[model samples]
Target: MWIPPPVRAPIGGAPASDRRRVCARIDRLVSGGQRQGWPWPLPPSGPLGVGRSRVRPGALSVGMRRRRPGEPLEPGNAHQTVPPLPRRAPRPSFYWSDFNNVAREVREFCEENGLVDERRLPSATELRFMPHPRPWLANGIRRHGGWKRVAERLGVRTATDVLSQPADASAPKLRRRGGPQKPRHYWREWKNLRSELTKFVCENSDSARYMPTVDELEAHNRYDLRYAIGLHGGFRLVARQLGLVARSSLIMRWTDLTAVAAEVRRVAERARLPPDVMPNERQLRQYGPRGLVDGIKQHGGLSVMAPRLGLRSQRHYPLRRKPRLFWTRDEADRQLKAFIQQCGRVPRVSDFLDAKRNDLLTALYRLGGLRSALERVCAEMDIAAVQRQDGVKT
Candidate 1:
């Protein structure tokens, strides 16, 4: 290394050993112990020691960063800015004015479209095209009850109000949304339904009280009448209100004993029994509907009704009681074994019910419970082994 004149002059006149030692000290001071064969200079031999790079501190880094010893550490650059959180959506404020605005919009829409009735009024989902805010309307509907209630409060016709009207007023059908509205059911009114029913009966049966059944209406293609009847109550209720009688119940006028007696005699003869001699009640049941038995009972009884039909009434005999079977444990086990054999295994209560073995069932119930009674029977008869051999669970 070529030393500067001023720096080398001091060592030039010294001894060889002295000059060599001075040059070594100058090299170490300039290099600061930096290693060779490296792109950048190595750091000095202490913690937080700056690297002895030829490049100046401010020049190597882009900024004028300088730190003195013993200062508090700070976070990354304060110059960086982050976008603030998006502003919160404003909470809805419910007001009657908002509700009324939506209602008026609906009303105007209905009027322009010739919707004079409540049944065909547009629902909330269908009101999207209106100018009023939908959220406010939804919240208002919830707060004030429901959509139907809100519509009613706003004086807009609703389905409940429209149902009781006698006839749906005909509106000029237009090609509107939801396919030209529901094909208006014209006879929705109570008075109109009754009159139509009366007219139908008079034309078909020529009897004012002959109320038509649902099947008759369906056969003649009067679906509207059936629907109206269901809405009011049902076929029976409507018939009762109009003083009408279905053909099924027309012959149910069992209050007249003379007519009832004649019917009974007719039924008895049909059953191949002698009509002159009063038939037993069991004989009449085979050839007649249940209503016949009910009617006879209503009039008085077979004894009273028989004489009126010119049939000689049979002598009434007092029924004698049969001997009651005392259900012993041995008797119960025998009956249960027989029942299990017939059923091919243990049976449920319904099996006893079906087999008409109420006495055994009563006795089983009289014992602790069915489980213990069954266990006692199985133990006494060795039935569990038999059941196991028979491939049935005991």
Candidate 2:
């Protein structure tokens, strides 16, 4: 009906048989050959169909044996090739065998550029390279310019190489700063003057008199005349100016002068006379001796006797009547001493009288009258006489 089927032409003009052969070869390469009896061609047993087969009896077929748990089945010998593993690129080799020569080149460069002192070149053993010595050298050179400049920059006047150098025979010897100088003679003189002044001030101060109060003499008997004399230097100088050495000496003797002056002042005050007027012996005798013996006996000998007599008052008083009068202080003193000696001591009022008697008599006699007068006189006179006479003796 329609035009005969379009005429067919072969592309690449290959025959079907050739294509089949090519496909067969590819199948053999990929899958191996088809199995004959055991899903693989068993090797031929010996000598055509003989009595005993050559194949071993217990041997396992490829399909019957369990491929060891995870193992892959063995491939046919023709197809058993492994692909190679990927590999890393190799590193380039560093040409370090020329290191010594490179070091030599560096040394030559340093010498040419004045980067180091040629004569002070470090030995090869000493010139060790750090991991990157060139960068360190470049940085050091940038910072300090060169080795000698670096040493100067670091305040090193003498190079380390110079320290290692032999000592110079022609160098000048160093002279050390000398020791402290001795003090001058005037220093000693000044010290001596200071010491003398200190001593003068200490000895001449008013405190040195040891007279802290006017009553000081009553407590301390030893007056320091040397200290008092030193204090009188101002007066002595005035006296000396007036050419009165004798008078100055008299005044300077504080003990003698003070005593005489005290006595004269007392007498003048009592007489109501001017200090220029002196007292005669009679007046002094009459006024002075009247109360003195009693005072001494009462105050010095029997100060404790007052309380024993039941007298509460500390006031001094005269005997109301004449006592058994001793002729002298010496006589009174002797009698007191003898009384003290005789009684094996003087008997106290408390010793002579019991407490009842002391209270009764003290109250009765203290009321005034003859008993009061008699008790007063007894207090003034020696206890021995009062005991013997028992009343006033004419």
Among these predictions, the greatest lDDT belongs to 1
Listed in order, each prediction's TM-score against the native is 0.27, 0.12
Across residues 242-342, which tens digit of lDDT does each residue of candidate 2 receive?
34332322222333433443543464468665544444444444544333323323332223333333322223553233234423434434443444354
lDDT score, candidate 1: 0.56
Clashes (backbone N, CA, C under 3 Å), per candidate, total 1, 0
Q: List the residue pairs that clash in candidate 1.
A: 166-189
Candidate 2 lowest-lDDT run of ten: 57-66
Error of 1 at 76 (Å): 99
Displacement of the residue 204 alpha carbon in candidate 2, Å: 9.8
CA lDDT of 85 in candidate 1? 32
Candidate 2's C-alpha runs over 4 A off are 1-194, 197-254, 261-394
